[model samples]
Target: MKKIVISISDEQYEKMDAHIKKGSALNLNNETFSGYGLILNNAEGGFSWLEVDMYTNLDLGDVNWSIEES
Candidate 1:
C-alpha cells in the first residue's frame, strides 16, 4: 500500500481548532476498502475512517494515517 500525508497552514489550523471548540467535526479524507472484508481478498481490509477531533490529536495505524494541528 502507498502512504500519503497532507499539511495545512497555521491560519487554517487555528480556524479548524476554533470550529472544533464550538462543537463540530471535520472530515479530512476518506477511502473505501473491501466491503466483503477478509471474506474477499487476504490483503484487503475492512472499511475505515480518519477524523479530526477538537484537540487536533489523531492517528490511525493502518495506511499511515495521522494528522496534527496546533
Candidate 2:
C-alpha cells in the first residue's frame, strides 16, 4: 500500500477528531480507522484520521504546518 502523508490545519484536525469519536461510539465500527491509527488513536492522545473519509485518502502534503512554541 502506498503511504499517504497529510499536513492539515488545526481547524481540520478538530473536525477529524469529532468524526473519529463518533465512529468509535458505535457498536459495530472497527473498519473506520486509518493505517497510522496503530501508532496512535486520536482519543488516546492527539490527532485523528478516518479510514473512510475522503480527506484521509487525499495526498495533502503541500500545506505548511506551523509550530508555535509557547
- In candidate 2 the C-alpha lDDT for residue 52 amounts to 30
Maximum-TM-score candidate: 2
lDDT of 2 by residue, 1-70 (tens): 3444546677657655675566555424555543324222244334454333432433222243233444
C-alpha lDDT values of all predictions: 0.37, 0.43
Our tally of clashes for model 1 stands at 0
Q: After superposition, which runs of candidate 2 have C-alpha atoms over 4 Å from their true positions? A: 1-3, 28-70
Clashes of each: 0, 0
| lDDT by residue (tens digit), candidate 1, 1-70 | 4434544456545654565544432223223221111111113464433344443433222232334443
